[model samples]
Target: MNATETFDWAAAGESLAESVTLIAGGARGTGRTAALSLLQLGARVAIVDLDPGRIATVAEDFAEYGTDRVFTAVADCTVREDVQAAAAATAEHFGKLTHCVYSAGAYRAQRPTLDIGADEWDLIVDSNLKGAFLTYQAVIPHLQRAGGGALVSISSLAGRTSSPFLGCHYTAAKAGILGLTRHLAKEFGPSNIRANAVCPGGVVGTRMNDLLSELHREQDLVELAKQTPLGRNVHEPDVVGAILFLLSDLSRFVTGATIDVNGGILTI
Candidate 1:
């Protein structure tokens, strides 16, 4: 109301303290990294993943954050019941849900476009796209109970562009994630909930590396970096940082947006 009024950025960012974040696929890669970052930002975190053993290890590693601040549940993102149970468990454990990140995805070995079978297509789509839908389906009610929250979906640069390395099924599924994320933001904005997607390009430390290893293209990172204007591929922290901004009050006004974490490889 005054021309001399000043905005308090630091005060505005204090919203992360004591908030609760639930991350699907939080046992490894970008998901795990994001969960850890949220802990550092003073948020309690709940990890949902398929492997109980790996979840145990992650929980052990996060012990420094205190057992009371970390929780885990076994869930297959593609399975509706599993996802629902994971969401309910997380909400019950935390008593309030404030943020969510769905980073679970399936990227099988690359095959020729013509050779991709229906089974392969369904597996990838269900895990990447439909899984996002189910996670939102399960988590939104809990998030609403907390008066609104932020949700981020992990997409890929391949989803935004034609991929020379990934299969058609993977590319299509990832692309669908962006569309799905936008719909969530539009539909939930009125409820004070925010949703966005992060599109990472050639991330070096994520499950994408496993795909390269399977294709015997593990050595491509060095060459790929040279093609980027930044002379490097994105690492785990790069994508994690983007997700943190979207999840926190820092991006309170941002929603339905795709934040690219590439090393300047593609700009759109």
Candidate 2:
């Protein structure tokens, strides 16, 4: 049969209908948007965040889906026990886990390399890079149990190139995510698992935006947009779309790939 005759476009739409996804840092920002988008696609969602208040707020926000379809846990991704428990609880609650989106990360006001302290460096690295490592460690077994699964990590355009608005530590941690994702893809390919990363540039209305607003004027963002071929910064949905594609069967053979969602900025 030809490719067109063999392709099931309807199946692609229902790819995630049976998925049970765990979204780290799903309380707000791109992670939160991903959770809502997945829920709309008929997937069961489990969201984990460090803040108890934020977890509760997201739980309420997802209440429309009812308890059977949604789960929420308070977890600090940097802590091994916390991440392990959350992952275990999610699989136990939902009966099986199929996908994970490791979106939990941190950033600080831009600082020079010489001015960055050890404590600050540790905080950023542990929060962004180490947290992703721990989350994958915790979720891999559950993915294995389900026979096969997908993992998507949120890297930054800073990971690919230097960031003008973030510190070196943030950039370093984001870069680490890319390397880690590639390693996971190679190591787990034999087990029918896939791993990928998404690198977004200057997403607006996110926590990063709030931080950048304090550091640079609105004009700076406009100037940055003008440099992009698309003439606009990324939005929450743009990053979420790339993530959803990675999670769905539409990208079944796509692994160890980094999808750039930067509105044509920083193309390689």
Candidate 3:
């Protein structure tokens, strides 16, 4: 088969009909979009987020997409007990848990290295790096008990390259996830558990996109796009497609990989 025909995407289409997925921080942004995507693919979903009302609202809005395929939980991925509770609830609600997407990361765009404070550094590190670590620590047992599963961490373009608009700590933490993904792949591959990451560039159509849209100048956006050979920014759907592939058996035997969903951006 050619590169385009490597995996059977049709398997993803219907196999997910009875599948159950647990998404961390799935109430909004890429996380929410991802949850909806998985549900659309026919997976029963339990979306975890920090906001009860927002989760409830989004859960209701997308419930029809899931039919009985959707559910919601209000839990902080950074908090261990909350993660434990959410995982337990997801398994109980769906009657099975097969995939885990650690999509809860924080980003606060600001002036480059010299302009940021110490506390801001800690905040970004704690959220991006520590949060990913916490989610893995809390969910490992669940995945293990399930006997085998797929674990995907959503990273960023900053991990692959430095950006003037994003702080160094954010980039560093995002980069750390790539290393972590490789380590987990080696450690858990024997158990049929695969670990991978999606590194996305400036993504449009998310809360972060709209927020950053307000902060970035047109020239800045264009300059950012220029780094990529594609000459355009990537959309959420583009990144999500790669993510969905990583989560599905379509990428079976693939592990410890960090996929770049950037239009063409790679640090020089």
Candidate 4:
């Protein structure tokens, strides 16, 4: 039997069957999709978001998963207390936390560096970078108590290169996430915790896509897709698959690494 025949494809998802995952900024978009996928894999999930309405709506979406396996917390990821509280609540509700996914970030309209205001920079940086820091800080201890875990941070292709549709602030924040993820992987590896990053290109159905649609002509969008080796922009599932891999034991020995889900648009 070769590697292919020996591989247990059906057991690939079983590694996460006992997982308890917390998704920061999980109310919508890729984060929301991740939550649903985790639940489907037989893992318990806790969703933390800044908006109560989104929390309610996503909770409804997960209603079939039942209350025992799903938890929701409404808190601002940028606030230390809120994030700590949410992490604590998640652990208390789920019994343990085995994985964390930081998908909370913001993007603003494209503008020249000179035209970008200080406030806008601060907001974007704090939301994308500081929020990840806080979420990691709050969850790391819980993971420690649980013996070990994994962390997956959602960065962007903009961080790897540049964004034609967003400002420098978004780029900087996402780039910061890559750095933070590496540092966490180094700092926590001794504790058995793993950390990795996923950089996805312009994903369809995301707010970034909405902004792109508004800013670029149809031909421009087509041109953008044509540039990628895959001949299309990334979709939610493309990124979610990467997230699920990092969260599962399949990536047990993989840490301090980056998996780009950018359809080969920007290869290093």
Candidate 5:
């Protein structure tokens, strides 16, 4: 794989240019970062988020990338109709949809499974798992009809195994995403739709990473770096690069797979 800094967009445009991609929860964090990267790579993108103001501002900021290429819609991923509307508009805007990236949700307050509240559990699950499921169901038809597309579902390292440090809901939802990806990949492969999950561990600049950022500033970054065989904490761009590969033709033969962008934390 080539470094993103050296990846030539012009060359990619001529060959693997993508017309439309949906970025859920794209107002901030990894979702927004990934959307920006995709835009820079010449993919027409649609930003879907619950926050209308932020969505509008981001769409405007990305105008220079291609006014015709950037789109924004305020939608709650937990709502089916919202996802449907967003999907329909995306299909209409780009003439055809080729990629679907679902990166929506929040991980707040680590609570023990025994102590987790009903509302808290609902909040995380609805946003992470249900939201992804709703968005995928809505956008998949468009991809299937157009012959096929790529899907990159965000999962977390906590999901790979039990974590006393992470909240129960967060890890569970992330694990669920993997199961969803596998099922979708198997069911949709014949239609040419490829689905994969990216499980990230302690992303450096992401919101989740901020939880212990101060304490981990120096000693921890070094320790975390060592935890990963790569000798560096995971970064948004690191995960995004993995994401783009799954979206591009480079992984055409890949599907029903889960890629761990955890800097070699789980080498199994």
Candidate 6:
């Protein structure tokens, strides 16, 4: 390579048509959006979610892409065997696994530190942190077999700072994701696999919003938008863009890093 030679950044950023990506918690929300974006870029995607109903619904919508390009699996991310099976199935169907995203998580009604019970903590931790661990463990070997891959896990703004909208369990689980991502990045870089986390602020019109609405704590969109420096709340697309970048060659050298997708909130 000479100084006169320029990197083909645009081509580098494009997802390969032969690429296969597996996404957990991809039935809806940010995960679904990212899966769609990757598919649009010509990558085959295998989406896994615990809810068979949700998977069916999303599959109905994805069927237009044809079965060769879209695959669906029913698996619980918290269960190691389930995650392992999902990974195996994905690789079997696609013939290779080139990328993975652990985007499955949940946020229930806020509970004070003292008021939160062991059950609540267990549920959140199992879903958010342990789930990510299992997904990472199950997928990395396949990625190594494929020579290399990219991984991005969805975290949250509350993970980085205290938030009025999130509970203790939710914050702790998301924070745990940051540590998990960094460790994987460090341990797997030699294998040519990169790992990163995306921390998104308040994102409306997501299943999280549905949870908030059920808790009677869903705030006015306009009010929440005003609080953001960008003058709008982050949406699924906003987060998906960052996720895609990290999962693409565009961020080949970026690993163990937490990219904020918040609307200029908590710029640390």
lDDT of prediction 3: 0.79
Clashing pairs in 3: 228-264
Per-residue CA lDDT of model 4 for 137-242, tens digit only, reads 9999999998899999999998898788888999989999999989999999999999999999888875855786677744666787899998998889999999
Expressed as tens digits, the lDDT of each residue in 1-268 for candidate 1 is 2334585678557677767888999999899999888888788999999888979999889988886799988899889999889888888887888888999887777669898889988988898889889988999999899999999999999889957777888889888988988899999999889999999987777566777887788878888898999888889999998998898777888999999888888897
Ranking by lDDT: 2, 4, 6, 1, 5, 3
RMSD of 5: 4.7
Q: Which candidate is the best by TM-score?
A: 2
lDDT scores of the candidates, listed in order: 0.87, 0.91, 0.79, 0.90, 0.83, 0.88
Tens digits of per-residue lDDT, candidate 5, 184-218, equal 99999999899998888777774645766533444
> Where does the lowest 10-residue lDDT sum fall in candidate 5?
10-19
What TM-score number comes out for model 3? 0.88
Clashing pairs in 2: none
Error of 3 at 70 (Å): 1.2
Q: Can you give the lDDT of residue 101 in candidate 6?
A: 91
Could you arrange the candidates by TM-score from highest to lowest?
Answer: 2, 6, 1, 4, 5, 3
Winner by lDDT: 2
Off by over 4 Å in 5: 1-15, 213-222
Q: Which pairs clash in model 6?
A: none
Residue lDDT tens for model 3, 1-268: 3556766667654655665778887888788888888877767888888888878899789967654688788887778888888888877777778778887866676657887789888888877777777877767777787777888898888888865556788899899999999999999888778999999887766655555666765466666777678888888788889878888767877999989898766743
TM-score of each predicted structure versus truth: 0.95, 0.96, 0.88, 0.94, 0.89, 0.95
Better of 1 and 5 by lDDT: 1
The better-scoring model by TM-score among 4 and 5 is 4
Instruction: List candidate 4 segments past 4 Å from native.
Output: 1-12, 216-218
- Candidate 1 clash pair list: none
